[model samples]
Target chain A: MADLLTPENLVNALSLGALYALIAVGYTMVYGIIKLINFAHGEIYMLGAFWALLVVGMEQATGINLFVAIVPAMLLCAAVGMTVDWSAYLSLRRRLPLADGLSIGGLTLLGVGAIFYKLTGDTTHAWYSEAAHGVFGWSIVALVPVVMLALSIGEKGGMLGRSLGRVSSDRLSALITAIGMSLILQTLAQLVWGADYRAFPQESIPAWMNEPSFHLGDAPVLGKELTMWVVALAMMAGLHLLVSRTKIGTAMRACSMDQETAALMGISVDRVIAFTFLIGSGMAAVAGVLYSVKVGGNISFRMGYYPGLLAFAAAVLGGIGNIRGAMLGGVLIGFLQGFTGGTFTIPFLVMILVLLVLPRGILGEPQATRA
Target chain B: MLELKNVHVHYGKIHALKGVSLEVREGEIVTIIGANGAGKSTTLKTISGLLRPTEGEIRYEGGPIHLVQPSDIVARGLCHTPEGRRIFPELTVHENLDMGAYLRKDKSGIEKDREHVYEMFPILAERREQHGGTLSGGEQQMLAIARSIMSKPRLLMLDEPSLGLAPIIVQQIFEVIARLNREEGLTILLVEQNASLALKTAHRGYVFETGTVLMSDEASSLAANEQVRAAYLGSD
Candidate 1:
């Protein structure tokens, strides 16, 4: 603990925390408004990094390349985020009667999963002999019918329908859809980019950017790290202002509280929700690019998976729907990595602790808590 | 002016509002009074474009508002302050008021109306920075109405403004309703459970029962009718 108290470690912790906060805020903001966990947010993060890598001159990033990388990355991610929201969640939500749509959606996904499993059997592991390699694909194919059957019985107005209709169709279905969205994004990434562990081209970084320019009380701070920290902090501050001061931001807060009420206020709930996703996804994009640079310039399809999970933990720790809570949670989670000397256990431990002890979260309120 | 003709609304399998017809002229306080399940609130919600009527026509300013989106309806000079004090719980009072004028692009107008609302509810001015949820129930209800007022509506639909409030607060709310109608020339469609209070405050009243209107007349006549008095106003 004493050795870890160094300025270098503290700087690392802060940078890591900034990344997690960027991702966590997406989860919390989505949850705050529509109460969807938006499990696909991790993939958004990954896509941001991937998109940045694809931007013009990123591979040979010299002077201004790195600075300009985030723009395209964020724009692409925001577009995808909004598109996914409209196509996946909105279509289901907009249907006249939710039950029919949910059943059809649930069934269609399962059928598609079946077709994918039947055809490729997960080509990533085609060379391997283990039949379980395609288990994730097979499981979705297998589970949908059972879930559908159980839910359909509720359509006949049984106790389950009366009690669990909102829970199952709205909350549970959205959650499952989110998980499916995450998997779909990963699969799509694999299909397009392949399952290779793609690396951020190290040549993109100017040598001076990686080398320490100044000392933070004897701890040398690299230019890239300084750049990332500043960008992340600025984004956080920008988010706070946007949510607090901007007209759209006020609409977002209103919708988060009560969509019906917001609608009466002449605030388009659909537009506000789309805006929330755009902002959150944009932040994830910035985080993705920054983290890629920080982690030895290596990028992968699965990079966001663990970090996304940790950011979620950070969100819950601070309070699910509270913005400031998410920021605090991210910093705390970053400190956990440093304090534990880097381990997988600390995050889960913190999450489990938060769930058990602080159910509403540190700053979360009873209902519609957004700031 | 607003008119609903043969409006049919359903909540899933249950028909919540059945062939409900109502109207409010350009400058009047129209109240619909009923028991909890009478679909009075549903009527206002349907008119606000929050709930779509399965069948029928809703015309605002002689235009079909039923086909319009809720925000569009509000933008076209209609607003609904829903049942319950529905405020952005985490947002400050000022923010809540700001959201009320969300569709308005005129900055100076918004500022002017905001000051007007603060004048109407002085307590809200003092609690401007406090979160909406932290306010007392009466205060929240006032904020809800004040927030709705910020929209500058030609026709405002208030659903049960007196619900769960003390008599004095209810009186205060009703006085504001009367003042808005008298001074601002604003038309109001009010849904209320307090039949006596609503009848006294409104220019006209409709009695609702089981998803349909049982009676419609001038407020004093409804108050005087033996059956209406027995059913809603009580023996006193």
Candidate 2:
């Protein structure tokens, strides 16, 4: 118990909590508005780490400004998040024909992934000859239609997407589709960045951040821990204000309550939903970058799986649709994990028990409607 | 201001509306009166672009509007207050009012219109911070209308405004409706089951029965007709 009270343990726990809180904020908001769990959100976090790894290469020429990677990482995450919704989730709500996922989701998440990294020296059993090595090694214009043609080969795969969008989108079907999306994203990450573990570059960790002792006396706080807390808190505050005070925020809350009514107000429910995805995915990216910075990138295609699940547990444990509840839930779970010495299953067990006792979780609305 | 010609609509396979036609002139109060499932609501929905016509044309202000989305239609100055007072129940009254002008960009104009709506409904001003779900049924209806008013709609379509309300509250609501039409010259298309009250409030009215308009005439004439009286007004 005394070991748990140490400043290092406490900082680790808070920083972990901050990571979960950032991801959970996005996770919970997506659920709050659209009622889809977006199981692929974890892959978004993983991709964020990989994007930072790309920036590490840039640092060789551009000096050690790896933080600049956050911008492209966030933009990429936002685009992927928004595209997934437009192609996979939203097509169900409107009567429009479905399975346009490849047009943007594929181009950005998969096609763009290929362009960033070469495959010749990376993967074995290479499909290309010596002349065609590493994804054209030059032109993006030549690859667009070929990838689209590959995706459009048959409706057999699109049958699942079309049926889900066209006929029934009850919670069970939606959940299944979300799980499928999660797997597809994982595969995309595997195919693009490989399944090997990558590092966030040692130099990216500023020496000052590595130095311990942020307090006057015996209490020690690494600057990296401070940076994590500050970044997460600032983003969360900005999100809170945006949701509560802005016209766009009002429209978003309105969409969460009832979309048909929101449309009547000239609010354009689709635009608000897209904006929600942009914000939520960006928050998840911040969590990813912060985690990579702190851990020196113990990053892999599967890395986001644990953090994503834990953050989801935090979102549910706090209250699925409430923002503050999600943040608190994340912190509490982070501490629980820290004190238990990485006995991670206990958090799930706790989540199940808490959910059985309170189906809406601690801060969820009693009525099952969004707040 | 609005015209629907031979509108046909199907809700899944049910054929909710078929070959319905009507028109609403500028600055006129037009009412569609009928019993339950008479397609009055469906007609309003088709006009407001909530549902597409399977075979028909909807023209607003001399342009084809049948293909427009509901939000775009509102931006074109045709606002809809749908049935059952579907206000954003979780939003504060002020935010609910703010969303009414979602497509507008003029900051001061939105503020001015919001203040105007507040003056029209003082209870709303007092409860600006309250969630819409907490309001009384009549107050919810008021917020619904006031929300539409904030958009500065040139032609307002109301679906069952007095639904499930106290008689006195209904009277108060009709007075406001009359004032909006008279003072502001706001064109209105009201759908109501209250035949007696609707004929009184409207300049002209259409009698809808089983997805078709059985009769259309001056409101006073429609009220006097024995066939209309027996079927709708419950009189000799």
Q: Compute the DockQ of candidate 1.
A: 0.61
Q: Against the true structure, whose TM-score is highest?
A: 1
lDDT tens per residue, model 1, A1-371: 58878888877887788889889999999888888888889999999988888763433644446557789899999998997687567754664344655555555544544564566444545323333523564466346444544554554576666678755754565666677778776665554454556555666656777899788888888887787788888988999999888888878777777888888898889988899999999999999988888776457667879989989989998999889899988888988885666676987787788778879888876654322
Give the clashing residue pairs of candidate 2, or none.
Answer: none
* Candidate 2 structure quality by residue, lDDT tens digits, B22-60: 999999999999999999998988887778898989999
TM-score of chain B of 1: 0.98
Off by over 4 Å in 1: A6-8, A56-64, A95-166, A216-219, A365-371
- Report residue A7 deviation for candidate 1 (angstroms): 4.5
iRMSD (Å), candidate 1: 3.2
Separate DockQ for every predicted complex: 0.61, 0.60
Candidate 1 chain A least-lDDT 10 residues = A126-135
State in Å the error of residue A226, model 1: 1.6
| Candidate 2 regions with alpha-carbon error over 4 angstroms | A1-3, A58-64, A95-169, A213-219, A368-371
Candidate 2 chain A lDDT trough over 10 residues, lowest sum: A125-134
